[model samples]
Target: MTNYDEVPYPDFIHPATHPGNMAAIARLHGVNAPPPESCRVLELACGPGGNLISLATLLPSSHFEGVDFAAGHVKTGNAMIGKLGLTNIQLHHAKIEDWVTHPESEQDRFDYIIAHGVYSWVPEEVRQSILAICQMRLSANGIALISYNTYPGWHQRQMARDMMRYHADGIEDPHKRLRHGKALLSSVAQNVPQGSAYRVALEEELKALDQANEAYISHEQFEDTNRPCYFHEFAAEAGAQCLQVIAEADWGDSTYEQVRPDVASALASLPKIRRGQTLDFFRRRTFRQTLVCHESVAVSEQLQSADMASMHFVTSSSLQGDQITGSNGLSGTVEDPTTRQAMECLVAEYPASMSYQELCEVVETEEPRSLATLQTDLFNLVCVGLVSVSASPTEVRREVSSHPRALPLAREQVLRGDTVTNLRHQPIRLDDTTAHLIRCCDGETDHAGLVERMVAYSMANGGLVEGDQVVTGEESLRVLVTAKMTSNLQRLAAMALLVG
Candidate 1:
């Protein structure tokens, strides 16, 4: 096995794997899943427990367990769990093959089993063991999320991986291997003949590699085993284990908005697994986070309106006129009057999620509509990626407090680096100024005290300055720091990084 202690993969939360989101997806498909508020969650290959710990902070009532082969990862994750004073989550140092051997592992079936980065990266035996665990250890109605690299898209990435590994595999140092591998790929991309098909694919792969972190490149590209399978093949294998893929974890990406209506109509006629495979072939999907359940479980892709009664809605999108502009800058027009108003309400709630009933009440107050009608409209918006649904509400402060307290997990993260996990289990990269501001939030510092601390820190560093002019006077520096502090605090609040 490759030692991850040498070049540790950066651990971060994946919101799609959150039990709340998974439960919502389950409900959308008519699966009677365990509630996210009290669900038992297990994560395989959970590095340092970043994702599990973040979930623990949010859902204190739920229990989380993570299993990893690496001792260093387990040690680091256990240390964080201790510091956070959380009793509901535990990180264990154990291989996946050995995990099922434990008596407790077999006894306590998890409501959610997550294998985020494990499927495509491991050998066939390990992969089979993962599926077996999911089959035997998952709750009767549980949803196990397994993410993997798929074919078509992986076909291109495989070529790039082979070239990089061929050039850099002999290197002993992991970091050097990553550097040389990337350099080799870059050189090929630059030297390849213009307008050739290979050049086009290589350049696209290089573009993706450029966005990836060194840890990702090291583990994903340079690892000994990476087996990308077709969606149908994966589905068939899961079926062999008595598991069925219900749907993709990301509902929006699974929609037919990208394909033509005729293609979608043709796909809709096919069986569920075949439809998914055909869709993947059309989109050339490189990766998938699939939600699987017991083969006997009755699954329905047609979402019921009643399910929304227990759900909440949230989005970082802005309602500009009739168009809802996503956080990523993609815009979708909401033509229906009621849905447009509902979108307005969702946008106003930004980081804080509003319960489905609460949003419907507010929207109905302005524009009357049946609950079923409203839910259908909202589901459409969800499929379009303009909004998202959650089975449990995300607890976050919409208003900045007099003495803002950052989440303990976030405070711990800031000490390590600029990237901190928010209340939503999403990672937010902070600027130096914002990171400094977060470090000062301890619920004891008053607004004025915070400003004074920022002013002093700024002066000691290099003094507060306006573009060209360095402000030396105490009053001017205080005023500038105050404004900057206020903006930073508001930004943190909007990011759901603040607790109280």
Candidate 2:
């Protein structure tokens, strides 16, 4: 076993691990899932509790627990929890084999169990143990999210991994090993011809590796116990433990819209699980975040718009004129006037979600549309990644406090650095101005006090300067500061960072 004491995985949020998403997907598939707001979540091999802690901060009513073999991770994560004053989550230092033997582990049942980045990195025995834990410890309607490196696509990456591992063999230091590994790839990439298949693949892999964090490379590729399996193989393993495949965490990947019509037609006739396996081959999917439930739970393969009635819909994508085009260009154009109007209404109440019925009522007066058409449009939006559906509605605090408050976790993170997890469990990158604005929202200052503090801070920090001249006049500075503060506060609220 590789001890993560020396090189720990980065503390980060994985959207797939969010209970709200898992529960929503389960419900979409016809499973009666637990409510995310009050669920009990257990994560195996949760490094430093980064993902779980973020969830704990956002959903204060929910309970979270994490178990990892790394004592260093446990200690550091516990300290962070203490600093944040979160009593709903905890971290434990214990190996899977040992942890499974505990009385509490046997007695307690979790509504959501997450094993991200663990299954493919461990031995078969450990993998089986994880599945057994999920089968034994999961609540009746609970879902377990397991992320792993999948096959067909991983075959290409493995060729590169083999070369890197061989080149770095006997190198004691991780940093030195990483340097040598990159050098080897660079040499090969430069020596190969420009258009050969091998050269193209090698260069593409090298570019990806260069962009990834050193810690990720050290543990993910160079780790000794990496075992990539086919989708059927993984499903078989889960089946043996009495868990059935529900659906994938990323809903978009499950569709065949990206493939040729002929290929998709052939795949459509296959069985549900077999269709997934075939799609993986055609898509060359290298990784997956799979969600599974107990064997007894019947999962619906077809998605019905009626299923979305109980769910809440949210989208950060902006509407331009009467079209709701995605920023990523993946979601094909939606130009229906009624659909555009609905999107505009949703964006106005940004971060918060309106139920399907509520949305219909709101837009019916402007352009009356059939319920089926509305549901179909919403589903299309979800497929394109322009919209997100959740089991729990957004918890918006509309009444700003005497001292307008932001999320404590986000506030602390902004003070320390420019990246912070928003209340929606998504990371928001901050510029200097935005970072300062977030740090100022401590719930201890009124609007005037905040404006005064921001003015002084901006002047001292060069934020108030336009080109070379500082806006120093009292009236000018106040107007500038107030406008900037209001804009940022609205943005923060839209991002779901503000709290009452």
Candidate 3:
């Protein structure tokens, strides 16, 4: 599974990456933390410290040291670090094996060690060396984060890879191999070998290739792009090196409820902490690369469980929404109303497992909310680890629970329902009377009928309010007779309600 990491000889884009609240992720996994100032960090294959620089900037009190096999990456990261005026960050240019194999090397222990792209891309021996570095260097209270490719997902990609590799095999030059892969994928079938699984993939890949720009093709077909791994196989490989699965990077999509497709159900009993369906657990349509923590922790001292200890684990992001829905049904902060609606859908779906790509699909192909809105909702979910996250193949650690009771929004009366589910998981917004009125809003109820109900109720009370005593207006909610008659027809239509 450690097939693709640690292989970038001298190529990497140097975009500044954002950092999640690692202190919080550790708390969810039952790990403790000292203050940022007291923490020591290490990042294996720190790509220009894009994310690490962000992390350092956010947690200035923390100390960081990074190693990348690519010397140029190290040089670039150092340049950024210098520009950022980072006092506590350091970098090294050397392979994991070279560093660990040094006999008299200083034992480099860390509080929180993260390696994103190196583990899966590197060769097996190098991967083992990286794990050894963790085992030998990770402090007691320290946690090591390693990311790699996963199964089930990789299984499908293997189909595409098989076709690519098959076409690639006949060519000796790397670019030629790439051309073959691109050609077969884009070419129309000329008596395609009957029922070849690779045939369809080749066509699809070809179409995608022709449409894609040159930059993408060149990067994807790099000489080192041939490495990959499976999910369970990755876990086993990590186990061999004494690493444990902490959680997936992106969370909230799969909680325990959704992922009920026949295939997911069959894997249901596999001792999953929580389960759900996912396409890309994080980012876009890319396959997963799991993050792992060392089984043996560093930092022997007991940690202080301040506000951070109780803080929910979520990806660090600036999403836009007025309110976000927690997996537990609690509403979180958002920038707008639309964001709120999107949160409701994520909550309603409540799958045990969801890939980042799958959630995007839900947002795009379904009701198609704004990308910013969906991201904000996901960010809130990530903060709490309710939707744990990983850009690579990852696992869900938190349990998924159903919303208490989804009550429909109506007008004039309140109706309690058991449970309603859908991908368009919007919230039950309207209040009791309003909700009931909405349900009955067929443009049929007359003001007379409204008055009759009021009068009948008044008669039962032995008295009735006169027209003078009652005020009615659009803004005044009491004008239920008219307001409930036609408030959210358009919105309901958008929700695809069958009501007339």
The lDDT for every candidate, in the order shown, is 0.85, 0.83, 0.48
Error of 2 at 114 (Å): 0.4
Q: Give the TM-score of candidate 2.
A: 0.91
lDDT of 2 by residue, 1-500 (tens): 34588888777678878888888888888999999989999999999887889999878898999999988889888988998999999899888866554236533889999999999999989999899888888988999999999999999999999999999999989999989988998899899998999999999899999888788889987889999999999999999999999989997876786789999899988887899999998889899999999999988887656688788888877787856655566545667656677788887777787777778788775344556667788887886688888888776764456678888888777765677887778888888777777778888888888899787776677556756777876667778888776666777787778885
Off by over 4 Å in 1: 101-107, 365-369, 463-476
> How many collisions between residues are there in candidate 3?
80
**Superior candidate under TM-score, 1 versus 3:** 1
Candidate 2 achieves a global lDDT of 0.83
Candidate 1 accuracy as lDDT: 0.85
| Candidate closer to the true structure by lDDT (higher is better), 1 or 2 | 1
TM-score of model 1 (CA atoms): 0.95
Question: How much is the lDDT of residue 267 in candidate 3?
Answer: 52
Q: What TM-scores do the predictions have?
A: 0.95, 0.91, 0.51
Q: Residues 348-384, candidate 3: write the lDDT tens digits.
A: 4333234445554544444445655555555545545
Q: How big is the positional error of residue 339 in model 3, measured in Å on the Cα after superposition?
A: 15
lDDT of 3 at 150: 53
Give the alpha carbon lDDT tens digit for every residue of 56-110 in model 1: 9999999999999888888889998998899999998888987664236544888
